[model samples]
Target: MIETVENRPQPKAAPLVVHVVRQFLPNRGGLEDVVANLARQTLKRGYRVRVVTLDSLFTTPDDKLPALETIDGIEVVRIPWTGSSRYPLAPQVFRHIGDADLIHVHAIDFFFDALAWSRLLHRKPMIVTTHGGFFHTKKFLAIKKVWFRTLTRLSAMAYRRVVCCSASDLNQFIQIVPDGIAIENGADIGKFADAASRRPERRIVTLGRFSVNKRLDHLLDAMTALAKRDAGWHLDILGAESDLDAADVRREIAVRSLEKSVSLMISPDNQTIRDVIAKASLFASASEYEGFGLVALEAMSAGLQPVLNSNEAYRVLAGRHEAIALADFTKPDAAADAIEDAYRKVATEGSALRESLMQAAHAYSWDAVAERYIDLYRSIEITI
Candidate 1:
C-alpha cells in the first residue's frame, strides 16, 4: 500500500509532466533517497512525475521502492544506459527523456544526462542538483576537480537552474556558475520518529557509504578515544561499502580492538535504519566533508542529539539551528568531549529540547522542498 496525494491542483488539460534523471534509484545513499522522495512528493502535488534512471544490471525491476509504484500519484520510468561510457549514454538518456516539460537531473557529476540534455535536448527546461563534489584524498580530489569544472561549464550552458543540497555545495559550484540556488535536503521525520520509538537503548550511530570521503576511519578513531574515557559507550556504523578502502577500515577496527565496542553493518532499508536510530542515544558523523548531513537530521528527528564535525557543510546545515551541537574534531579531545556533552544535553533538557528538534526537522519536509523546486522550474524562461 503506497501513499498517494489524492487532492492536488491540476493544470487544466493534463498534469504538468516532469522527468527526474539520476544514475541510480532505490539502491542506497543520500542521492537515492533525495530522488525517490522528490518524485513521491511531486506526485502528491498532482504532477505527472517519472523517474528516469540508468539501468544497472545489479538493480532489478522487482526492487521495492516508493517511487517504483505511484506513491503520491507520480509515475516512474527507469531507463537503461546501453552505452559503456558516459559519452555514449548521453544520446540514449536524452532519447528516453523525450517530450518531458521539465528534466531534473540529480548527482550530475557522474551521470551523462546533463551532457546529453545540453548538447542534444536543448528545448526542454533542464535543472541539475549538484549533490557535492567528491573530496576524497588528494588524488581523488584532483581527478574529480577536473570533472567538476567540466560539468559546471556544461551545466551553465545547458541547464536553466543549478540547485545544490547545501551552501557548501553551492560554494563549490559558484566557481563555475555564481548564482546556483541552495535547496537544503529533507528527511521523513515521521518515519524516523516511528523508528526511534521502537528501538531499545541509547546507542551512538553513524551512517554513510564506507568511502574515503566519508572519513569513517576518523569515526573509529573517535570511538577509540571515547571508549577510553567512557567504557559504556558503543557505536554502530551503517552504510554500503563500494570502495577498496573499506578493507582498510576493517583492518583499523581490528587493530584498535574495537570489535566489541563498535559494530559495522551494510546499508539497510529506511525503516530498518530508523529502527537503529530510535534505539540510539546520539548520532555522530566524522566525515571530513559532506554535501548535507541528512542522517544527522534524521537522528535529530528521532530525538537523538547530533554530534558532528565542525565542517562547513555541518555548520551551514545545523549551526543556525540549536538542535545539533558541533565538534572541532581537529583537537585531540574534541570528539570524546562532544559525544559526552551531547548525551548530557539531551538528559538535562528532557523532552522540551526534543520537541524543538522535531519541529526543526519538519521544516525540511519533502513537500516543502518540492515547492522550492517548483518555483525554480517556473522561473525558467522557455527558449524558442
Candidate 2:
C-alpha cells in the first residue's frame, strides 16, 4: 500500500508544491513508491504538497475513485485519463497544476514534458526525475536514439534539475542531458528491522512486477538448473503481473518440471512481504536492469543475502559491498552456480554480511534523502 503522513497543522509558511507523475497511488511500481514516500517526507517538512496523476487504469482498477481526494495529509488530483496502463494520456494537465511554487515531474511522459515546456515560457521552475528511463528493448532503443532523445533535450531546457535514481542511470542520461544528478532511492530500514529476524531456510525469494525486463523467465531456468543438483532449494516469486504474462511464467515452470520447487504469490500485501523475507535464506533477482533495486535493498536490511543478476546497477552495488553476489543471467547454468555459492556463503559468513548490508541500508535512509530533496527545493526557490 502507498505510505502517507497526515497533513500536519503547521504555520502556513511553506510553499505549495505539485508533483506530476504519470500514474500514482493505487498504481504499484518503483516510481509510485518513490513519489508516495517523497510526498510523505515532504509533508513532515511543513510543505503543502499535492499529487497530480492519472486515474486508476488496468493495474489499479477497482471502484471508480474520486478525481480529487486526500491521502496521508496530501491532496491528490487525478486528471482525465484514457488509453491503456502502458500508454496513459492525461489531458488538461496544466489546468490542474493550480498555483504551485514548483513542479516535480516523474518519468518521461510527453504530456508532462509539454506542460514543463509551457512552464518554461513563464520562467516557472520544474524538476524532472527520469525513473531509470523506459525498459530498453530493441524497439525502445531505436525510439530512444531519435524521437525520445530529441524530446528529452527539448524538455531538459524546461527543468531546473534532472534527477537520476542511480549512477548507472545518471551515466546513461548525461550522454544527452549533461546536468543530471544521481540521488539513490532511500529505504525504510526500521520497518524491515522491526520484522521478525531472518530465519534462514533453504528458501529464496525475488519480487517485483512480472515484466520482461525483470528476466524472471531466466530466473526460473536458473532455479531449474540449480534444483537438479540441490533438491532442498526452493524459490518464492512475489509481485503483481505486468508486461509479462503470469500464465507464461507458470507454463515455463511446468515445462521445466519445477512445479514443486517454485511458487508464485501474486500481489502479496506488505505484511506478507515482511514475513516472506524474514523466513528466506536469500533474495534473488534475475533482472537485467533496475533503477535502484529497492526490493533487494529491503531484503538486505532484513538480513537476507542477495543473489542478483549481472547488470550495471547491481554491479555498482556489488562494487560497494563485495558480499552481494552477481550472476550472468543470460546463462542459466552459470547463474545456478552463482546462486549455489551465495546460498553456501549464507550458511558460513551470514552474520558479518548481514551487518554490512544493514550499514549499507542505513547509508541511504529516507530521513537523509528527504533532507537532500528539501534542500534542493529551497535552493531552487531562492534562485527563483
Candidate 3:
C-alpha cells in the first residue's frame, strides 16, 4: 500500500527543493496544478520547495519575483524570464536553484532550461516530467513534429529521471527514452463530491480549451446527430477559446444548425467548472489523444459518467470497468452509440453507476498521488 504524506511524520530538517517550469503561478493547466500540489505536500512533509518559472501567459513583469510566499506551509519563489517564449533560455534560473537538493523540471519542452540546468547545476538531481509534447499529429504538421521530437529527445537525455503523468504519456516517452517512470495523476475527491451535489441539471458537459486536438468539433457533430434523433438532448462546452478557432467553431455550429442544442461557455473558475460537471448527466470528452485525462477522473469522482475514447490513459486510469463508458472515436457510430447508451443507463441505473464510479474514484485522491511521488523521491539517491 502507498503511504500518504499525512500518514508519516515530518522530518525535523527542511529538505532543499526547486521546481523549474516553463510557466507557473497563475497558469490554469494541469502541469501548474501538479507542481503547486507537489510543493504544498513536500512542504507539509517538512521540505523547502521553491518554484522557478518563466513569466509567460500567467505571470507578468508587474508580478514580483524572488518574493517568498508560503502555500500549505511550503515556500515558493516565482521568477521572471527574459526570453519571448514561455520556454526561454534563462541562465539566471539555475542561479536560484543551486542550493536546492533536487531540481524537478515540469515539462521537457523547456529544452534550453533543461540543458542549461543539467550542465550548470550538475550537483543537483534533475527530474523531468514530460507533460505531453506539442507534436501530437492532430496539433502539429509534419515539419513541426520533426522539430519538437528532436527537442524532446535532447531534453530527455539530460534529465536524471523522466516522469510521465500516465502510462500512455510514459509510453510516448519510452519511444525516445525507454527507462521512464509512469506517475498517475490525482485529484481532490472531496471537492469533486461537493461539486457533484451542487450540480445544476441533467445535462452533458465537456471541459477543455477549444483546440483542434480536443476534437470539440466532433463533440458538436455528435450532439447534432443526437439532437436529430432526440430533440431533448443538450450539450454544454466550457473552455477558453482561441480567436483563431472561435470563428471556425462558430461557423461549424451554425452550419450544422446546432445553435439550440449546444452551448459554448468560455473558461470559468475551477469550482464553477466542477459545479457544471457535478450537475451534468454525463461528462464527454472527444479528444484525439490525452496524457492523463484529468477532467474525466474529476467527473467520475463527482459520480458523473465519462464518455471517453478507448485510449491507454483512460484504460489505465479508469480501469476495465463499465463505470467509464469507453468509446472508440474511429468507429462510425461510436460517439452516437456511446452517448445514447450512457444517457439511457444514467436514467435507469443511475444510483448503481454513481456508487461504483465513486468507489473507483477513491483511488485518485491527491494525498494518495502525493505519497507516490514522495516515495519515488525517497527511492532516488539524492547526492545533493
Query: Which number leads on TM-score?
Result: 2
User: Per-residue error at 342 for model 1, in Å?
Assistant: 1.4
- In model 3, the worst 10-residue window by lDDT is 194-203
Question: lDDT for each of the candidates?
Answer: 0.68, 0.78, 0.69
Q: After superposition, how far is residue 350 of candidate 2 from its true place, in Å?
A: 2.9
Candidate 2: residue 223 lDDT (0-100): 89
Looking at candidate 2, the ten consecutive residues that score lowest on lDDT are 2-11
Which ranges of candidate 3 are over 4 A from the true structure?
Answer: 1-13, 58-91, 111-113, 116-122, 138-151, 197-202, 241-252, 330-333
TM-score to native of every candidate shown: 0.83, 0.92, 0.83
Sorted by lDDT, highest first, which candidate order results? 2, 3, 1
Judged by lDDT against the true structure, how good is candidate 3? 0.69
Runs in model 2 with CA error above 4 Å?
A: 1-13, 58-63, 120-123, 194-199
Residue pairs in collision within model 1: 4-72, 196-278, 202-281, 203-280, 203-281
Any idea what lDDT model 1 has? 0.68
lDDT of 2: 0.78
RMSD to the hidden true structure, all candidates? 4.2, 2.8, 4.8
